[model samples]
Target: MQSNHTEKMSSLGLSAWYGEKQALVNVSISMKANSVTAIIGPSGCGKSTYIRCLNRMHELVPKATVTGQVLLDKEDIYGPGVDPVMIRRRVGMVFQKPNPFPTMSIYDNVAAGLKLTGMRRGKSLDDIVKSSLEQAGLWDEVKYDLKKPGTSVSGGQQQRLCIARAIALQPEVILMDEPCSALDPVATAKIEGLMASLKEKYTVVVVTHNMQQASRVADFTAFLYLGKLIEYDETTKIFENPKEDLTERYITGKFG
Candidate 1:
């Protein structure tokens, strides 16, 4: 879990505002390539906002503004001439809830993004969908029922399907926002397991309220409070001996 990997993405003095209210305040953190970095905090700590900024999703909201730089592979994603669409494709995201396209077939749901971008078609598209599902660890479970509506699957399967959709885009980074918050323990375990293998191919940044989940799946962990970063370090250290008093208290269940 403590391998020496190169930094894949980082935010430098990044701050965000939703209309008049600031959601993030000069927060900065780095994620290593092919590793999982977990962001843990109590509600309204800007966990979701932080990850959204990574892919420029925050700007999609009305009155949302961000200041500072988010570097992906040493280049600022918000720099001049950079397309937000391409940034999102390279840094895919999975939401807190499973949100498969309700109107599309399971296979179609995964192919939707590719088709929208006009990236692939025919047999090549088929192959990508299959490969993506396999990567998501969902191929064996739903391969035969590819034609079924996406929502036909169990919540867990649907979440994996959403992941497959993201993988289909061949992203370098995957940002998940409380991915297991709506799942049962057994289902949550499956997603947790997927995160371990996912980091082998893509940099993963997950926002979770569950400290235990962060400890179990993340190589590095960041603790945020009231939109400010409290501490960040190897997961083992964060859980066992955090450098910040607030981090220690939060992890020890004394306060958040």
Candidate 2:
């Protein structure tokens, strides 16, 4: 079924390579505004590479090259004269592991990006930090402990802190690459719970190996294999009645 929502981001014939090896092959998919889209595939299927390409992060690696276009709201992000740093600001990323800046406090970690961009210490910055933490669903837990080291938090809280850091930037799109992989079930559930509220403000794309996680959080799901997009559809349809044989096989545990 066709979706009525506006397309917030999309890739047109996007392909990527690392030195001599190609990691992605002509992958094209659209992510809708204010929704969560999940990229699911086995290891080595280029799920991470694909989302990395969305925000131009893939090119940060040496010898990494890309072809085609990544569009955010119909503008090609790879267009000449476009600043990649700005693209990254507009499309934030969260990694598999919680990686709060070790030397900074939780408050400082969330404020780091803003400060680097020349936002000075002030009430506005303070409000942004508190609001971001609240948006990440972490304000009450650590409101009184903001002075503590960012790395001092539990793995789960640290991840949420990282999310708050990303949220502080007010990005238009948020990309999570296996964000819950390192967390315990309780922590994973909390992160998963945050997804619904997050989509109300930022477009979210998550790369997850856990099919259950994808099924639980995503509005749309894309199944990839061998660096190719096999199917992209609504989450329910993808899980309950996928179109491609490869997708069916993988979803059914026949093979990855």
User: What are the per-model C-alpha RMSD values against the true structure?
Assistant: 1.8, 2.3
lDDT by residue (1-256, candidate 2, tens digit) is 2254889999999999999999999999999999999999999999999999999999999999999999999999999999999999899999999999999999999998898877444569889999999999999999999999999999999999999999998899999999999999999999999987899899999999999999999999999888899999999999999999999999889992
How many pairs of residues collide in each model? 0, 0
The lDDT per prediction is: 0.95, 0.94
**Model 1 CA deviation exceeding 4 Å by range:** 1-3, 121-123
- Give the per-residue Cα lDDT of candidate 1 at 150: 99
- Per-residue lDDT of model 1, residues 162-217, tens digit only: 99999999999999999999999999999999999999889999999999999999
Candidate 1: TM-score?
0.97
Compared to the true structure, candidate 2 yields what TM-score? 0.97
